[model samples]
Target: MTVIVRDFRPEDADAVSRVRRAALPFEVTTPRSVLFHVESANPAGKYRLLIAEMDGEIVGTAQVGVAYESGTPGQSYANPQVHPGRRGQGAGGLLLRTAEEHLAAEGAVEVYAWVLDEPEFRAFAERRGYRPTRSAHFQRLDLAGGTLPELPARLPPGVELRTAADYTADPRPMFQADAEVTSDEPSDIGAELDDYEDWLAHTWNNPLLDLGLSTVVLVDGEVAAFTAAHTDGERRYWSGMTGTLRAHRGHGLAKLAKTDSLRRARAAGCTDAFTSNDAENGPMLAINKWFGYEVCATEVRHVRTFG
Candidate 1:
């Protein structure tokens, strides 16, 4: 069977979502979210979604783009996913090659990808000159059956809780908070959130982002901590980001926002909760452990530099 790689079409949302779910079950994805990503991507990102078709059926897909928000140039990312049942058909390799070629044409000097921490997956990446840098764990919680901690009786003085929806008039504060926290995150490639308009178009307006379910903590009327939530509108939910501003590190506001969001998610009938954390983030990892979230899978960030 001949495998062909091509750009994703609007009608390929289902197939693309299916491939991603099969490849990375810990994350929640939907057809609408897939289309929204394609539609809202900034041109500076040079984003491209490609699918691998075998006999007119899409069996694999990849998202390739430059890290437009990064302070450094030539940093790009491409994550390719093949259906579990369709592995070994050369579709994954084709998708990866297509993605890399596209990024290279766009002047990307270094490309990064996430590979499952299994032996085979690591070998696949190593064979293509990608070297593993850091690892992260995908954790899951049984929100429906497990008991969650009760919200604190009273927040610390000068602290209050709110949601992203509360900032309907202006989201610049949230953007600034996100940018500050994101710059300090541990990762293989460094990134800085530089564009407010791009962040709004891609993250703030994402269909899966439940602003009402996302909790933010305010200390003295400043955005001090936040837990961003994303959902598939059914049984699955994800913590997009849980971060604390620099000045509020030890106050447990991050935990407060996360717990409040998780409680709201469970109350809304979300059965499963998922989050990813860098292996080195001890504080966040400990917090997740307290919530009964267990590590289900791991992925290593891998990078390849063009000669």
Candidate 2:
């Protein structure tokens, strides 16, 4: 059977979510979140969701987009995921090729993708001229039964624990904090979060983001640290970001924020928690480890520059 890659349709959300869950069990995604991503993508992103179908069955999918938020232009990304059992049947190659073509047409001079840190996965990217750049680990925590660190019984003097929902009236402060935090995050590609409106549309409004579960550490009324929580509307929770502003670092604020968020998520019916961290991010990784999050999987960030 021949594998044909085509644009994603609205009805493909469920199937796409199924594939994603199967291919990356440590990640949290729902059909609603899937649709939200397509509906809310920034125009400058030039995003495309493509599917690979063979014999009327979708075997693979790709997320292609220009890094519109990048400080440097010509940076793009395409992540293709084929069902584990369906690989080697040409679905992955077809999906990647389709994504590359779309990205190149959008003026992308380089493309980045994450390949599972496995022999076959690495070979696939290398064979196609992609080289490994950095690596990240997917970590999972069993929130239903495993014990999480106890939250501080009382605030530390001027410290207060607040949920992101507490700032519903004006989220500009949250937006600004997120921008500063993202700029300091470890990554091969840097992002500039200058557009408050764009962040409001794509990040704050994302359906998967659980504002009630997101924890913010307020030091004397300023946003010192925060951790974003994403859920699948039920039992799965993911930590989107655990950021401590520059001046607030070295105070164990990141750990405090994550602890607060994780406790909130488990109490809200989330049985599992997942998060990823670049290998070089020792502080965050150590915080997650202290929470008993085990390494579930590792993916190598691979890149290819176009001449």
Candidate 3:
């Protein structure tokens, strides 16, 4: 059997989602989300969803794109995921090579990817000149059976909980809040959210985002913090982001938003909840632990620079 890498076709969405879910079960992905990502990617990103096909079957998928939001120019990423059952078949190498070529053609001088922290995965990246920079953990919570902390009887003075749906008429406040909080996230690449229209196309209107389950904390009618939620519309749910504005950092508003969102998810019949955080994010890690989440897997962000 021979494996070849090629651009993703419109009909490959389901197979791509299956490969991603099989490779990273802790993450939420759907056919519609895959297609939306490909269709909505900004041209500046030079994004390409590549598929590794063996015969007529798609055994691996990779997302290649320049990180246009990063503080540095020409920084790019090519994250490839091969089905666990299909590894050691040369598909990974082909996918990586194809992605690198495409990114180089697009004028990327530095490339980055996430590799599972396990021995073989790390070895594969290291052999190809990728160096480990930062690590993150994928945490999971049992929403169907495990115990969850009871909601506080009283919120802080003048604070209220609201859902993203409440802002259907106007989502500018929530977008602003997201922009502020995201700019402060820990990363090798510092992103500054400057385009509201881009955010609307790529985030607010994404197919995986669950507006009803996403919760926000309001301080005197102003957006203070929020926990964005995404679901597969059945059993699995994921926390897209949980952040608190600088002014409201000490009031536990982030936790409040997340807890409210999780409760809503459980009530909606989602059996499993998942989230990920950078290794150095002590506060968010502690909050997840407090919510009874356990580390299910770990991944290291690998960087490869072209000289």
Candidate 4:
């Protein structure tokens, strides 16, 4: 079968979403969310969404872009997803090749991707000259019936809990906290959230993010910790990013924020909760475990260089 890889069209929203959902059932994906990503992406990121079609039928999709906000330059990312029913075809490779060429042309020095932990997926990445780096697991919580931890009776002194909506007038403080914690996150490609405008265009404007369910822990007026939440407008809730500032790491602020967020999410009709954690992040992993989340799937970070 001839697989043709090309730029995504506005009409490809449903097809792109279908492929993503079929390839990775654990994550929530919607047509509007996909369109929002493409339209709202920062131009500095040089973001491109591509699709692979076989006989005029979409079979695979990839999201490619530079880490424009990274403190460091030349870092890029490309994540490809092939439809489950269409897997043995050449769509995956074609989509990946197109993504790499696009990124390389855009001055990317290294391309990072996530490969499923399964042997076949790992071998495919290795065959493509990609080296494994860190791994992260997708965790799931049965919010419908399973028991959740009771909210703590009291928080530490100088600590108060709030939601992302509370920062509506100004989110720079939350952005600052995110920048600090993200810089310390374990990964092969380093990121720097130095561009406030880009962050606002992308992160802050993302459609799936539910600021009301996102919990923030404020320490004496400073954003100490937070758990950003995202939902698919249905039953699933996602912990988009959860982090604690360096100075406030030991005070259980991360837990406090996440706990508050999860409680609110459940109360708002979210049935299932999901989050991803780097396998080597013992502290965060322990925190998620304390909340009764279990690993449902794992993916390894893979990197490949051009030239």
lDDT of each candidate versus the true structure: 0.93, 0.93, 0.94, 0.89
Candidate 1 weakest ten by summed lDDT: 187-196
Model 1 TM = 0.98
Give Cα distance to truth, residue 175, candidate 2, Å. Answer: 0.5
Q: Model 2: per-residue lDDT, tens digit, 210-249?
A: 9999999999999999999999988999999889889889
Q: Mind giving the per-residue lDDT tens digits that candidate 3 earns over 81-166?
A: 99999999999999999999999998999999999999999999999999999999999999999888778998878999999999
Best by lDDT: 3
Compared with the true structure, the alpha-carbon lDDT of candidate 2 equals 0.93
Reference-based lDDT, residue 202, model 2: 93
Report the lDDT of model 4 for residue 101: 91
Q: Which pairs clash in model 2?
A: none
Candidate number that wins on lDDT, 3 or 4 = 3
lDDT of 2 at 232: 92
For candidate 1, lDDT tens digit of each residue in 1-307? Answer: 9999999899999989988998899999999999999998889989999999999989999999998777789999999999998988999999999999999999999999999999989999999999999999999999989989988897779999899999878999999999989888888677788788888988899999999999999999999999999999998999999999998999888889988999999889899999999999999999999999999999999999987
